[model samples]
Target: MKSGQLNRRVIVQRATSVSDGAGGQVREWPEIGRPWVKASLWSTGRGAGGGQSAVADVMQDNQAFVIRMRPRDIATGDRIVLDGLNYRVRAVVDPNGRRRELQVSIELEVPENA
Candidate 1:
């Protein structure tokens, strides 16, 4: 595959350390490595509440969308749009666990325009 097409965006996301409601800590990706979904770009804004907020609230030129793909549709070199930014898939994987969810790491920019 051409490396040029592998352009992507990456953001270090934080997963909350959930308590079992008792006395235990657990970290969840919520949806696993952020999935790349296509959506129209929107303006940026600020948020008021705590916890996870919408990308539009934090991104400068934000894009927003609801993902519409089967878990298997994700692959390396695919273009993903998250928070109005373009990202290229760098790595695709499924961390060993009880589920078959995939995790993808994307880069923030592409050296060459595609």
Candidate 2:
């Protein structure tokens, strides 16, 4: 992967359980690392009816993205944050199998209301 292609900076976070001070643990996403990555829009999908509007129709948006960066300890449960949006990691792949680079597949889901 070319360094020039890594034009975007993103934050990687991992889920952790922290004491909530009420005798229970609360889930939290803590920043793990900030890395420069090459991000590409993989795909996008919208709600049914292909943009038809209806009161019962709930708009669902699924955006898939692929990021390439140097090999790291990223995992499936980890998340990538870009532009203040959180993306769930779906898959990780080492294309060349040489550990030189990693291709991570991440996705974001948006509801109609928000």
Candidate 3:
């Protein structure tokens, strides 16, 4: 039998600002946590980004992402359908090794306007 899919909670963090020990401040020194991220892996493939250099150079692309539902309802390797849109899961990774949090990247089928 095939294994059942599971859903997990993940937090997305972005750099912010905070006070230093000496009552000073710095950029990219603080991070704010975004809660309630729901996504699942649809499929996996060779990373898309590449560069030509002295040696064969390649880099892992941001995992394609699609928000499946509001609040939270998705799992690893599950196709996400959000707002009538679709995205694929690349992978979930730890953020910066500063704290234990999962970072998920999703590639939008259609780009959004800011």
RMSD of each: 14.7, 8.4, 15.7
Best by TM-score: 2
Pairs with backbone N, CA or C atoms under 3 Å apart (clashes), candidate 2: none
What ordering of candidates by TM-score runs from best to worst? 2, 1, 3
Sliding window of 10 residues with minimal summed lDDT for model 3: 50-59
Across 1-114, the per-residue lDDT of candidate 3 in tens digits comes to: 011221533343333466777999864412223234545442334332221111112113433442222323223433334444444333444434443344444554344563
Instruction: Estimate the lDDT of model 2.
Output: 0.75
Which segments of candidate 1 are over 4 A away from where they belong?
1-70, 97-99, 111-114
lDDT of 1 by residue, 1-114 (tens): 233433443332434578887798876433335533322223234442221133223233422222222245555555564665655554544444433434444444443655
- The deviation in Å at residue 50 for candidate 1 is 22
CA-lDDT, candidates in order: 0.41, 0.75, 0.37
Better of 1 and 3 by TM-score: 1
Candidate 1, overall lDDT?
0.41
lDDT (tens digit, per residue) of candidate 2 on 24-112? 99989999999999887763443223112221122224666778889988998798998788888877877768999887878784544
